[model samples]
Target: MNTSSEPGDSLEKQAGISLREARQTQLLKVFLVMSVIYTLYLAKTLFIPLVFSAFVALLLSPLVALGRKIYIPRTISAFVLIGLLIAPFSFLGVELVKPAERWMETLPKISAQITEQINEISEKFEQEQNQAEIQAEAERKQKEAEEASFFDNWFKDDEPEAKVEEVKEVKENVVTGQIKQGSIEIFLSLLASAPFLIAQMFGSVILILFLLIFGPVLFKIFIQDFPVVVDKERTVQLVGQIQKRLSNYIITISMINGLLGIATATAFYFLGVEDAILWGALVGMLNFVPYLGGLISCTILLMVGVVQYGLVSAAFLPPAVFLGINILESQFITPAVLGQSFRLNPLIIILWLAVMGWLWGVIGVLLAVPILVCIKIILEHLDVLPHWVKLLESEG
Candidate 1:
């Protein structure tokens, strides 16, 4: 009886120890993951351009490879490709300048119109209020006005005209000083950031060019290091699949956005909307942010419609049409083109977008889906985390 009891006690002790160790290991992993996320957040400036360059290189690599087949130098081909990529955007920017300026100039008018409409609505609603309520509101306003007037009289000078002029001068000086100080602060901030911005831009370009030049050779070097033949082949296949999917997704999405922009511009122009190109460009760019982006674009279009066409049946048409086009694109065109490979769970995508957008702002939002696609491809190929893959996949 004593010997049997000893053996059972020993077995129970061993099991408890093992369970404790497993819990510790899980906690350690959680700590390490938190640390890594913090590090990424701190070092985003360095990493943002690096990640952007990697994606751009992935997108442009096939063209560079084709150039190599024709005996064109990678450097030349890269430069030409970058130039071609920037040209359309540069043209769009140039075309947007006048419209943007006009919009800025008309903003005051828009504000006034909006205010007028609001006042009109308020007046109409005011008529619906009972006489007692209206009288009470009027009395309240009169009391406040009388209190304000008392304060003004208490501070009044004997010569009212001179006092008013002096007050105006003082207010003007205060306003001018604030504007000047704000302008200076803004200028200084931009001045300080200019170098970093320029360096980041140049660095991204150089990185893209280097990647384009040496990407194939680098792949070869990477696979050469695998110890076993099976591992080597797996790595090669994995990298190939990731590259193919990423490049195709980027290229396909870009073409879709370009077409959407063109269609939007044409539709807006025919709708007699001013600054059609600007709105079109904005819609295309913001569409990158998935669900949130479309909502924002619709809201902006709605505002433009209200401001440009006033509160009429015509005002609602622009956003309604925009919503329709976006629905058609998102529902039909994207599904047909991308198919199932790049499809991710909607919840997972939203969470990832929120996390990344918090971490890296707009660029992070744009890169989020591509990064998820890369992760999905790797996980599927490695077969290590089937549950994670399931969570990521759109399948129920």
Candidate 2:
């Protein structure tokens, strides 16, 4: 009995040790993850431009290769492609400035007008409610009188306490003033940060040009240091697959978003929405961010519609049309075009977007999906991290 009990105790102690070891391993993993995230947040200014350049390089690498097949030098092809990419954006930026400024100047007035319209609707609703309540009260009193015995009537209090409701007033002028002040502050802050932002943009463009021209050569050199022929071949194949998957994803999504924007602008223009082109460009840019982007675009459209149409039934048309187009694009067009090539768990995508957004900002939110695609491609090609692949994969 003593020997059997000793063996059982030893088994229990071994189990306890294994549990402790597992807990330690998990803690280490958590710490490593936290450290990486903190580092990313700390170095965002440098990483943001670097990551953007790398992804852009991957996207344009195919075009550059095509140019090489035609005997165009990489440098010249890179410059030409970059110029083509920047031209339309620059034109759009120039075209949008006046409209953007006009809208900014009128924002306070728009806010006040929308508020006033809401107040009017609220007042009408309240009046109808008050009339219904009065009618119900009168009927209730009459029924009570009909049912009351003389003794009950004599026992009842002659007068009951009256309940008074406080009516809150919305001060449109005060709201407008606050909005105007806040806008002014925001504009000044943006003006102050313009130089830094421009510098980062310039750095990104230069880095992209360099990466587009020399990226392949650098990758080959890195692979050569692997020593074994099999390792070199595997590394090259891995890089190639990542580039292919990312390039296709970016190019297809960009085209889709561009078409979406064009459709949005055309619809808004026909609907007599002011600054239709600006809103179109905005929707296109914002669509890069999944989930949050469409919600924000719809909200802005709703407000703009209300302000423009002044609470009329037709006021919902702008956002309704925008929502319809978005539903078609996301649910129908995207699936048919992209299929499962870049699919990931929606939960994983949202979590990654949140992490990246917290670490960086709006640019991080835009880059999150592309980065995730690259990661998914890499993981699929490698045997390590099989569990991660399972975690990231979408369910059937």
Candidate 3:
């Protein structure tokens, strides 16, 4: 009786079992990750403010620490810092209203100019098409004439007097009443949401203040209570590294953007563009979102250009100059200032932007890079995922 299996068979059995276990483990991890992503997307409204507060807290942590060192109360420092941060933005918002209203008033004129430009382009295209059709018809007729037999030519009727068809132009009728009603409805809806939006903003500011004051204390408590199985010292180091990197990244990027905004505003003013400050501020804020931000800034500039210059070749100068400035800032200034350590893989950044933008819209897009950097840092510290961290590094 050969009850004992051969050594080769046992080894093969063990290898098969191990392979299946590996696959199962991988599948479970993928499932869990997807579940987490779905949960985040569903709970975005609840989480976005909290995440924003955390980031603000991280940004202000250094100031809070300095205050503590100087014997200032944490609460006082948080309040003062938050006030300083909010004041300029509020002032800028107030300054933007007049320019915004002026632009709104010019919308109808701009629309007319755009329509005329489209009509001109369409007419040029139509003329080219008509010439091509005429030439083709002539060629076909010449070929038929060459191929004609004497009897066939004699039997054909005099080409039916070369009948010309008249084309009737169709004009679309727009109902002004319907448009007005729709605009009123949209305005009412936005008005209804205004209070909610204000309340959310106020809540976020309060949350940020509280987080700034208490975040470090909470972090310390967590470190103390962490399971003995984990290396407490390493955990503390990891936390410190994340805070330092995030703070530096946010502060450096903000300063760069502010400089860019100032340059843009100065350029626009010299170019005689209206609402130069508003456009410049918009460019700075949107530039925080990477690819999409530049696109939006360029589009808005182009629209304003066309409105200002009436579709002339000169209408392109404003956006073109802004684009050049953006190229320089993104390619040269940012890398030089931030250094290689802050650079990230463009492909991964784009994918992360898409995912986050899908999940949380503009807010998601704004936070995408910071979140990606945090993930990269965590993975770098994990013994099992060094490759992932490497993949996230800039190729250059």
lDDT of 2 at 351: 92
Clashes of each: 0, 0, 0
Q: What are the RMSDs of all candidates, in order? A: 6.6, 5.9, 5.4
Backbone clashes in model 3: 0
Model 3 C-alpha lDDT per residue in residues 62-172, reported as the tens digit of each score: 898999999999999999999999999999989997987666555555555566676667667766776677678777766787798877766654431132112302221
Expressed as tens digits, the lDDT of each residue in 1-396 for candidate 2 is 898799889999999999999999999999999999899999999899999988888889989999999999999999999999899999999999999888877776776676677767876887677667767776776688789887776775532113212333434456657877776777778779889999999999999999989988877776786555567776777778878877888999999999999999999998889899999999998898877889999999888888778777877898899999999999899989999767778888889999899999988999998888888888888877989988888663
Shift of residue 316 alpha carbon in model 3, Å: 0.7
Off by more than 4 A, model 1: 101-116, 126-131, 136-199, 225-230
Residues forming the 10-long window of minimal summed lDDT in candidate 3: 164-173
Relative to the true structure, how large is the alpha-carbon lDDT of every model?
A: 0.82, 0.85, 0.81
In the range 238-351, model 1's lDDT, one tens digit per residue, is 877888888888889988887887888899999899888899898998887788888999998998988878888788988998898899999999989999977788788889
lDDT of 2: 0.85
Best by lDDT: 2
* TM-score of structure candidate 2: 0.82
